[model samples]
Target: MQEYQLALKDKRIAWGMAIAIEPLIGKYSGDSIRPGENAALDWNLPAGVYRAKEVVMELDKLLEAMLVQLGEPVNGDPAVLLDSLQANLAISGQHASLPLGPLALKDKAGAELTSQAVRIGEQLVIWAREINAEKRALTTYGAETLGALEFRSHCYGHPLIPEATRLVWGPLGGPRIMQLYNEYLHQFVLLRDALLPFANWEEVPFEIKEHTEFKGLRFLEPAREIFLTQLLGKKLTHKAIVQYAQSVVNSGLTKTGYGFQYRLGTVLPAGLGESAGTAARYLLKWHPVQTVQTEETRDLAAISFDYEYDDYYAAPRNEAGKGTTVNEDTLPVSREHYDGPSIARLLPNADSDRTTLRFSLEMEGREFTVDLGQLFRGHRFLYRPHGNDNAGDALTKRTSISSHRAIDILSHAGLVTNPDEIHFIPTNGNELVQWALLGKLYPENVVLLDKGDKEELEAAYVSGKGFGTQFLVL
Candidate 1:
């Protein structure tokens, strides 16, 4: 690599190997272009153009082979033509990235344990990309370095040779394939570390800090972020934020909490400075823990559960609940889908506390749990409606919020979106006449009484009592 860099300039080069890849018509450099700039740059050809004649000759023959494949004559601007061909080859034969499996948590001995009672760091695997080009593919250049160029381009995330130059020079050489792969792997690892994603709560990890996955929470949208900022623009609370989250169904709670200033009593910024109130990336987790303490609470044979696929018939040899049924079809379709996983909220002998909500799914002979609160903690911010706050009677825009229920009130009262911000608040049973001045329902009360989504309510009620798991509708 070092030797070729010294003499790469001033060589009239034909760059590229395939037919469709348009050749870079001008000189090239390590200088990456700006966001909107054109690809062409005014490059001064480098000095050493002589010592590479032999490899360049071999490139001429390779060009002939590529031309034959394209059914085109090998007679034009060699550098440009060859480069165009290589680009086309790349487009047609692009390599694919491999799929990453669910992140795992395992003991030093590699045993998977329940999240409620375990410890371990999350594990990640890195894979390398393929780089298999041909020597016979090089054509008409003074230096045949197609392979070397391929490896170098990927390593730098920038192309080494201009498509035009490669036609005349590619077959000469490129960076070591092994070395390039290693560098790519190292950089990707660093990039992943920097991203620091909020956990996917849906997976129901077997461990706490290690394999936590959020089930119902999805990425908080920018629009919702703005709405939340408007709602609690004065000061934010993690609690009110969680309440607001119930409406979105699959979404997160803002990680923001009240921040205090000497002048102000207890306050939090919309999102400190440039962040717009949504950017304090943190370490968060969610996982499930199962207990086998009592007789009735344990898995049972007498009360066999029904699902789309597979059935249970047997019980443990002793008193403990046990079964040997296997079915892949019953897996949770969406981590947030409030259907079967209700086991955490249903089974008579399930959860220990009212605060716990469980998302369940069975995969590969193992049961998984996704907790709502755990998922909320993983994200940086929560969604809040902008317009409403406080108990109200009049149709004031700023004090009232926008919600599935409140939408009717705001629309009928002619005060929707009139305020700079709005927020959604879950409805609690309350009489509007007593809470209002006009002797009618208050605007906030309108939403509180807007019982439109009955199915969702029914599902939540079932999940909450049936399996000791509750779904906060958001």
Candidate 2:
């Protein structure tokens, strides 16, 4: 595609973070028989789909007298509450996630005293915020009980801020992180609204603390991350875990900028669900491959595509000029309140001394700033954009991300000039049209991920510098 669009304006490469896991309920079988317990038409017909593991052995001895008071796995990890005791149990597809007796929205002694005196039983995080009624501004957040780490304040109505969203779990050790509890975010929004589906639970009934964010859109990839690892304790794969949460969502609606792009699709491409401009709550857990074993299941109903790239939203720069910098330590696209005092003082080529000019936008992002030598004019970025990466902060820890044609600047920032949308940058080996397009190129732009590429951008081009994992599986 024009030699990958001249390797992202030439010079600047190296990028990593390649997470690919696929599998969706490998052996699902919920709610054994929704139409009254015992006689489901003598196993005949009136309805068909079900899988609470076919009534988990007839609600396994009253589910230990109703979750023996619900406890376990805040990190102990032996699969607790079988997914909050499977929304009041009742399965029948092939196996067992069948608890089915308390949470139908209260009753049964208020859902078995909310799984025993207010979940004194640990793990059920649930942050999933989205804000923005008009311009409130939060947009997206995650943690609906996914390796939480910390939360507390009667347990939650607002206030989790793990630095405001970017906690994609997969590795934790000791002290975990969850304090929040408000009846466990209201029994996880009543077990995520009684498994949704009642015409989408009256659409938007809200109280506040209730939340969830899953993406079972399953375009395919997730059948063996571990296969229901004892009722979801690990072997994780919410579709490579929400594509790592659609890579941190940049969906500002079109334009070369889907940077942290991840699609969910059930509606709300930019309509901003929950009856507002941003109450936020995207879900899409579709099972069927005849119940998820994978292989040809594309009705593709649930899809998420916001931030449709402004069309000319910006990034075609090349107003023609000079802009040099062999990387002496600039990194300041405007820190917080900026118009132009930071970007290392600008210098379209301080005084020339070469064929046209040199380059260096060094992939910045705090606000905006990009000239990078105006794309090296005609000479064609010398030796493939020029050589870059490890921009001192974000770009997935920098492993492989050079520049010259970075999937055409990430399909022109995500305007998707095709190239299959370029995703999967294992440090910099390019495989699906070749990866390496880092987070948010604009929606305010988001970089500074992990950090490492050739000693963090050759020590910031010779001294600019930049800078863990155990396992929580997700």
Candidate 3:
């Protein structure tokens, strides 16, 4: 194994293999260009032109292969065609960027498309630049001097890479699990060092920072760093570690109570800046050692007594309040009868002439009808009847409605002919309201709600509880 490892270290041999992966290495370099640009920048480019020329030849072959696959005859010779452009560059010192089209060809699917042309073109440019760079380096520096460079550049024999390779190519399973554990372990160590000063306090105003994953798997969106920050000075807390753990768990479970707008399955937690700070502050307020202990004890006591009480009460009573063969099935179920209109009857009247009556609905299991007029009564700044020019209710236009619920309510009311026409603006402040507002009854029209909802409405919007259902009704 040592000999093989040492054999792999031969710079000449390594360089030969490394040249094949040049594109992968240069994937992020500034010199990357499209296939058309590849031909234009062939000669008089840099020290890597020879390797880049080789890559261009490979690209032409690949393009020819693709054309053959598509049943298109390979007509023009790319080398011959680019000869003039290459000459123009040397003579003119400035060349026009030529756009090579039809480089990518694709068959479109419904509302989606898959193409390989751009990817292939990019790969060609990267490989060419990388191969050229490596060739230049080998020629400039002797083989003995290039050994360390080859080893480090290729990252050969790194402890983690071997393990990663084992996981990727080994017969054993759970390499990913191991890798994740190591990543999290490293993160915890970093976090521990950061929080070492405040690790002894009972409670500290702590915030979790989000870190982007610079190694391993990447995200379409850059991930944020997560670590607890001491908001109350630099003081350490006795519960700092516990609070940090709780915050980590909480962030994992509820996305730090920012809700599920952006939840990922990675064990490492993430959070938004402002919202995460708000959540951390809220958590720290009740996250002391005493608070956690008290809550736990209280919860345990409540569970114990509740179970005992339930067992005692449900202990199969008869004429003497003793266990009996006549079971608890004989117990009568209580039903509270309502003397008012049923929910179906109280659903917003489709043809009601009164503006308020058109939007009012008495939901099932609730005693009162939800009156849109009363709900928005004096608070016209936050809501209004649609199509009304009330200046006080002018703020309604700023609030967004949920497209999903809007379509359902409109369809139920016989108002919308095409449901797909209803679109929700994700950028609006009411985006949360749109997702949270689960209406009890459908309606023909929707009332305009403003961005500045009251605290009660805001709470309902967050929890999807209470008469927040009414927020979506017409």
Q: Model 3: which ten-residue window has the lowest total lDDT? A: 300-309
List candidate 1 segments past 4 Å from native: 1-99, 102-175, 196-452, 464-474
Q: Compared with the true structure, what per-residue lDDT tens digits does model 1 show for residues 1-474?
A: 011010112211111111211121112232111121143111111211111111122223333333333223433324444333233222122221111112132321111111211111122210110011233333322232322222221222322235433433445322333233223233322222211221322221111011112110112233344433533243333433322322122222223221111110111212111121123323222112121123554321111111111111221111111112212132111222222111122112223322222223332344443322222232222221222232132222322223223112212321122222222323231211101111111112112112324443332222211221111213
lDDT of 1: 0.23
| Global lDDT of model 2 | 0.22
Instruction: Report the error of model 3 at residue 196, Å.
Output: 19
Query: Model 1: how far is 131 from its true place, Å?
Result: 17
Local distance difference test, each candidate? 0.23, 0.22, 0.23
TM-score of 3: 0.15
Model 3 lDDT tens row, 1-474: 011100111110000001122332223222212122323211111112122234243223222221122221222222322232232212122221111122121211100111112223334344433443344433443333322110001111112333333432344323332332233223222222222222121122222222222221111011212222331222323223223433332223211211111111111111111121111111112111110112233220100000111222233221111111221122111124423221111122212111112122232333332222222211211223233323333232212233332223222321122221112211132221221121212222223333323432332233211122223221
Cα shift from native, residue 412, model 2 (Å): 7.0
TM-score, one value per model: 0.20, 0.22, 0.15
